[model samples]
Target: MKNVLIISGHPDLQNSIANKTILDEVATALPNAKIRKLDELYPNFNIDVASEQAELLNADVIVWQFPLSWYSMPALMKKWLDDVFLHGFSHGSTAKLGGKKLIVSFTTGAPAVAYQHDAVMKHTVDEFCYQFETTAILCGLDLQPIVYTNGVSYSARQTAEQIAGQKDLAKEHAKRLITAIQAA
Candidate 1:
């Protein structure tokens, strides 16, 4: 079985509508995949570096799933990256994370249209997510396109529409990630 690790980074765990839906669907579809709720595990923001590295060392694919806050990751997720992805463990000499595939699934607080250069958000989705993708590349890991949804201004109707669309999107993305994992 392919080992997949899901790192959820949403601060408000209870109210993440889109993120939870996608993760649940992934878990159901890929029952063998390991789901690691980072926030729940490290609420005090103290990450066990060795243990986290061990988890990363065992996974074929690592997924960073989170909601965009202030155009970046939540403080704890950034801290997790800082703490867990150490010099020797993830990218340096030891290179524990090398050869692992990386996928970033994220949600934004703005409408999709607003991500355009001329739009209110003033930047494209890909541009906004360069840091995460670059990190994977630097670690010698294959990277996938970042999945994003505009959650900020979405109304009930819009949310329902997006929710309906998310099922297929999530499955497709999961299939792509899984295929890569198996191939690796």
Candidate 2:
């Protein structure tokens, strides 16, 4: 099995329902995968660049797991990319991250239908992710198809039974993520 690295970018993991559920399921399903909770690691947003680079270098498959905030990743995740993906290491002649597999998995408060062109957001999730895809291309990483869980906010004010159903949905998404990782 390939070494898998999960970079979890949830800002408030404790209060999260979908992200936390998905993470728990992934951890249980793939015991060998290394998970780094970015917010926990850098609460003050002070990233240890060398350590982050080391983790990336050691893994074959890298998963960026987060809750979509304002149609993008959390602030710390953007900072992580800025700090760890340096010119020489992630790109340029000395690039060490070339050929690594990259998978982006995220939870969105908005329903999938909201991302349709004629819907409220007026754009698809994939359309909002062009920057990430371009980053993978520039870094020479093999970008995998995105995995996302939508309608998460719909469960916010739900009853106990409804919340349980949301958890089940997260579990299913986690299973799909595991399948994607296995394929990678």
Candidate 3:
């Protein structure tokens, strides 16, 4: 079996509905997968670079799971990347993270209609995934097709029924991600 490492980049999984549900389903589906919850580990934002690098070294499949925030990943995950993915460690000639599969799985607050060239958001989900593709290229990681779902946002103002619907969408997203991981 491949060593699957899922990095939960949600700033606060406990406060989350869609992200948390997706994670729970993934955990239940892939019991052998190693999940690293950033918020729970580093509330103070002090990332352990060595440990993270070690995890990267050990993993065959790496998944970055998070919610769409400000057109990018959560600040905590960005910090973790900056601290752990050093030039020589994640890239450059001496790097060892090449060829591992990277699957970017995320949910957007807005619906699918918003992510289009002529739509309100003015860009497609694939456009947003360019950065991940570039990262994988630079690091020599084998970038896999991204698994994403939109309109999964949840808010306190939402009705219980609406929240339940969003949770169901999150479960579907998890299943798609699991399929990608299994293929990887």
- Model 3 C-alpha lDDT per residue in residues 114-181, reported as the tens digit of each score: 99999998999889888989999999999999998888765532798888888889899999999999
The residue ranges of model 3 lying beyond 4 angstroms of the native Cα positions read none
Best by lDDT: 3
Runs in model 1 deviating more than 4 A are 152-184
| lDDT computed for candidate 3 | 0.92
Would you list the rank order by lDDT, best first? 3, 2, 1
Compared with the true structure, all predictions reach lDDT values of 0.75, 0.91, 0.92
Instruction: Give residue 20's error in model 1 in angstroms.
Output: 1.1
Return whichever of 1 and 3 wins on TM-score.
3
List pairs with backbone clashes in candidate 3.
Answer: none
Backbone-clash count (model 3):
0
The digit string of per-residue lDDT tens for model 1 on 11-80 reads 7666656666667877877788888887889999999888888888889888888878888888889999
**In candidate 2, what are the lDDT values of residues 1-184, reduced to their tens digit?**
7999999999888887888999999999899999999989999999999999999999999999999988888899989989999999999989999899999999888889899999999999989999889999999999998899887875463788768867887898899899999999
Q: Against the true structure, candidate 1 has what lDDT?
A: 0.75
Better of 1 and 3 by lDDT: 3
